[model samples]
Target: MGRRKSHGSSKSKQHVTHQRQLSLAKRNEINALCEKLFVCEYAFHTALSINSAYVTQLWDNYVEISTILEKVKRLEEMKTESPKRSQGIGQFINWLKENGANLDGASVAEFPGYDLGLKAERNFQENELILRIPRGLIFSTHNAAPELIAILNDPLIQHMPQVALAIALLIERHKENSKWKPYLDILPTTYMTVLYMTAADMIELKGSPTLEAALKQCRNIARQYSYFNKVFQNNNNAVSAILRDVFTYERYW
Candidate 1:
């Protein structure tokens, strides 16, 4: 990190009242966690490669993590239950076809161990079209901009198209008359992404750079969460106007 050039501004800053503010304790906690994560990385490279004591100490963390991984892996491999996601597949497929998708030869089905996928109902020649979605049916920041026009000037939405699309998806999902209801309804309540990993699960990546990457990502997300937490609380932009009242962070995620 480089030092910022002073532009003759006062060192002491004014604290403007906000409808929401990041809690001092949570801010401190995030700082502490980031420090600890960096320290772990520092400890990794602190000693020379020839240091036996260093290697031995790191090995203990490895063994602890490996035990949990093996148990989890074994349990998953042994599981026989293959739950088919049949909740709203029919409705979603019907909705897609009704709109503009070409699916005469393809249908969605759940295979064992594979949650859900498109299955061929009949043979098709090479390069034949099996599906086509209309522009109006596709979800993207471009299509969703009108609903979020009030926050278009906000830097986060301007810079992060993915975030904007995600917010739009959530907004639509909450509406009783959403066009994407059938599709969203069939989606899982949660996913197994790194965000879903627990702190203990993070330990499994101890010796890997992935651990640091995950930590950095978590801290970054936390900071952003605080920023948006304030935004949703204080501003009455399209996003804040409707979300501020019922916005649980989980849905935002």
Candidate 2:
């Protein structure tokens, strides 16, 4: 081979080697980061479940959260049957204890609700809150370990959408109430997943331009608001109220 060709070939080989190393390193870093994030997310939701106040709200609007409860039950059952799956759950919790240090840890103070750390600049769009996901989602313990992963799996979340929709519609429908109005300011991360799932379902079912428009609008609205933390503020009462007023099984039935 000519000297110039040989030199180019050597450089190309080095570049390929470097690229491979970088890709491996990136994947490892992402995996580590995801583990920590799963913990933080799990801790927040776990905190949400423990508070009596939220539980009472859920009870009052029993129908709204019925789906969510079902999904949780399915997940709980999976954990019981599979030790490896359960171990993933444990690792997630440990990650929370370690990495969630910086987030607001005043679970007692935030009773019935907690914020996962997400910052949004002013006038962010609605779709920003809507999780980007592929259809037909399924989650095992590994994906469930991180909160984001769980959120990604939310559409496949089994039973949460009806309740989530009730909450969102309540906020949108009850535009007059000052207290309830703010809840609509941003969709919660959990609810955002539900919304995406719902939209995805609708897209698949009808493929209607109207539904497509609605999904697009919802995403745009989400972007304008920022992440769910600023908007939701853990208002279980708000959720309950929406569930009671807006959603009846008959409507879905």
Candidate 3:
């Protein structure tokens, strides 16, 4: 009999192609919506400035556009589904095992408030080892790209170790096939940090002693981001490309 074609591979290729097309279409739609939303926002602001009669209409349109933008964004994200918890965690566990990690009695579990919790599956005696992670497995500026490391070492940058590490992480996160993809995939998309909270959300913290501290912290971070943005803007290098997106307040928080 004649050789049979591999329909599985063909179908896989078709599926990938279809997904790409869908993603491109969604991106185009989002772009169009964003342009319209921008115009609406500008009109609303203009109306407010002159105290125009159409202020309410413009404001309503702006709100509607914002809602649609959010829905489109969510749809795009759903289409580009992140790796499942089991898949990402399983991959990390396999990697650890391959690297001679001693994760015998320890297992990952989901808690009520806490997202992921490390639990001891079995009873451990005194002085018994539960889990041991090798230093080599950790991601740091040391293991980052040579160009990135050079940037971090530059006197002009003058960033602390944590800042350098943060920049390195942002660069890696932007890469399509990053080695840390599995690990990064598990990170929370949105944090409950004060930096991310809306004004309405902040009202819940009224009468709290930490409210002032949180506001101060937010202002400090904004200043730092502005400083970093100007510093990197002057340097026209690959480092700037990475650091450009890294100095955002949201990223810092």
Candidate 4:
């Protein structure tokens, strides 16, 4: 009986060790894939000025890279049973207060159903300013890279605020040690927008009018991105900064 118990314990220990090894291996694989994706992204940006056909191929590669990145990010999020905001979030709120935001009666709180939300600390009268966020704290295309800003100022692209903002948001998102890092850290890594949903998820919305609208918006944004890619292909500065195929339906939504 003693021998049997000892053998069983050994087996259990081996099993646990195997699981840890598998987890480590998976993590290493993901890291390798992420590196490859970055390389692909760099190559795609470099090819933007070559030709339309080559650019299209590179764009497809970029889409694949993005899709894989999204999957890995989702997997990482799922592994965490209880997701908590980073310390940067608290700093961000403090920064907001210091930068002229007024948080008097309302405080940012975590609720059961609503994730992070504004809650009333006390009874408030009508028309009272519970919270005030300064305009400078807001992220917009106006603060995008100089190259992107120049492109946005173009007579043709200037009229398309949505496209311009989406591009700017993506550019800022990829920046290393960005000024908005604190706020960006608190932002969701994934969205429930129709653009990111799988076909099975879309099935839930079958026959809904909003689905058609979502599809239309996707096509319109893709068309706009394509037009801009062709028009700015000769501009090396703009083309180098521009991330092709990033203006996805998810980004627009």
Q: Give the alpha carbon lDDT tens digit for every residue of 1-253 in model 4.
A: 0000000111112211011122555545545554454444323344434454553454455356556656544433322121354433575677678778898877666677555667799999998878888788787766544457556556545776765665565555444444554555456555555556554565565455465455444334444433443444335555334443222223323
Candidate numbers sorted by TM-score from highest down? 1, 3, 4, 2
**Considering TM-score, which of the candidate structures 1 and 2 is the better prediction for this target?**
1
Candidate 3 accuracy as lDDT: 0.51
The lDDT per prediction is 0.54, 0.29, 0.51, 0.49
Using lDDT, rank the candidates from best to worst: 1, 3, 4, 2
TM-score of predicted structure 3: 0.57
For residues 1-253, write the lDDT of model 1, one tens digit per residue.
Answer: 0001111111132111112433566445433433332333224555555344664455444444334333422322221221234655777788998888878889888777767788999999999998888898787766643667777777987898776776676666543355666665556555666555665786687676465456555444444444565667678676676555434334444
lDDT of 3 at 198: 52
Clashes of each: 0, 15, 0, 0
Best-fitting candidate, measured by lDDT?
1
Please say which candidate is ahead in lDDT: 1 or 4.
Answer: 1
List residue ranges in candidate 3 displaced over 4 A: 1-86, 153-159, 226-234, 242-252
